[model samples]
Target: MLIQTLAAAATTAAPQNKFGFVEALQAGGFIAYATVSILGIMSFGSFYILFTKFFEQQKIMRQGRDVGTSFWKAPSLRDGANKMDKNSAWRQLVDDGLAAEDQHGKMTDSMEAHDWLHGSLARSEASINARLAGGLPFLATVGATSPFIGLFGTVVGIYRALIAIGLAGSASIDKVAGPVGEALIMTALGLLVAVPAVLAYNWLQARNKRIAENLNGFSTDILANINSKGAVRPAAIAPAKSAAPAAAAPIKK
Candidate 1:
């Protein structure tokens, strides 16, 4: 009788939890599904940005090597600019400097031409930096907000659990475990999503800073060259007015 009673008690004991993520999702309802979907999107977007930006930065860094060798070896500013990859940041800055030198004389009330050229280079550098920083804000948003979204789902799960308990009139392990597991899963998923986003944001930000620093240094070199060699005349300068032919003087001969 003792052995039989023990066997019956063991059989009645709660079965091992075969329940898992899918079951939790099924029990969590629409709110849980939505939360997971949003987190999934955030994760995908952050990873995509991280990878694309990494490749872009790597390309720029490699271009830096080319700039060091080929650009300086060229005979003139135009030649140096041509030696750089056409789409490179260094080439862009050089082009802007050349344009600024050409256009400075045309702007009424402009500062000294040197100052104008420097300002144009500065603006070009800023534009490149801004382009490099694109998509970073979205990573930051995901890092900052994903946890809250998860917490919101957790709250909903707990509320549902309470309702289930109330309806069943008993807080048995089976009734309580599924909802609690769902809530915990939501929290864990949130942390998982947020951690990568935050890491990627920081890593990408650091890389951007390095790129920006490189751009600033390159711009400075271009400005120095412009200052030393006098601005390269653009193809479009108007012919200098020839001094009216010395007023064909009376034939004093």
Candidate 2:
């Protein structure tokens, strides 16, 4: 019944009685109609980028959490590196630190430990930002460009309306309203496309910032663990003194 009613309404709008996207578009006045087409394309691409990036960032955050938890539980730095989830960005940082050093290498103290942590965290954070920022440029473009596209349609529509007025030699409500109304449709469509894109851009930026903080927290935790283990040296400290006895004696004199 609803479909039939809609069909009837569509028929009243057109001479041949058909309901379709093209037909509805034709009724939209030329400028308004063109605005719809341009905005439609931009909105499609913007949404695709927005959703895909959202899920991708979420997955990265989850994996980062897993990596941080696993690193804290491991017995040693090497062990932590091995135990961490491979997919986590933090895990990659640990891997980089370990790989940069030799088998006998160790973090030593708070400063070196901090350096390693900082480097690891910085690298991962940079990467996460890059990923999070992905496709945002397109959204920015859509937001900026859509209004102009609409304005162009409106300008064209107004031009046609003016021409019609000249040709008829009289200003009739029907003649003026139809073309002018159609042109204003383009501007409305442009706003429809731009507003959502701007909102999405702001939202994604906040999300990326939160994710960066999480990654930084993980870096600090890894460094703290390294500092804790650094304090536990050999009980005697004998080897260094014995190996440099002559040097020790000169200092004692």
TM match of model 2 to true structure: 0.68
lDDT of 2 by residue, 1-83 (tens): 99999999998887753324454357555545557877899999889988997897888777766663555555566776777
TM-scores, all candidates, are: 0.82, 0.68
The clash count for each model shown is 0, 0
Error of 1 at 146 (Å): 0.3
Error of 1 at 144 (Å): 0.2
lDDT of 1 at 58: 93
RMSD of 1: 12.5
Off by over 4 Å in 2: 1-35, 67-69, 81-85, 102-121, 224-253
Model 2 clash tally? 0
Q: Whose lDDT is greatest here?
A: 1
Clashes in model 2: which pairs?
none
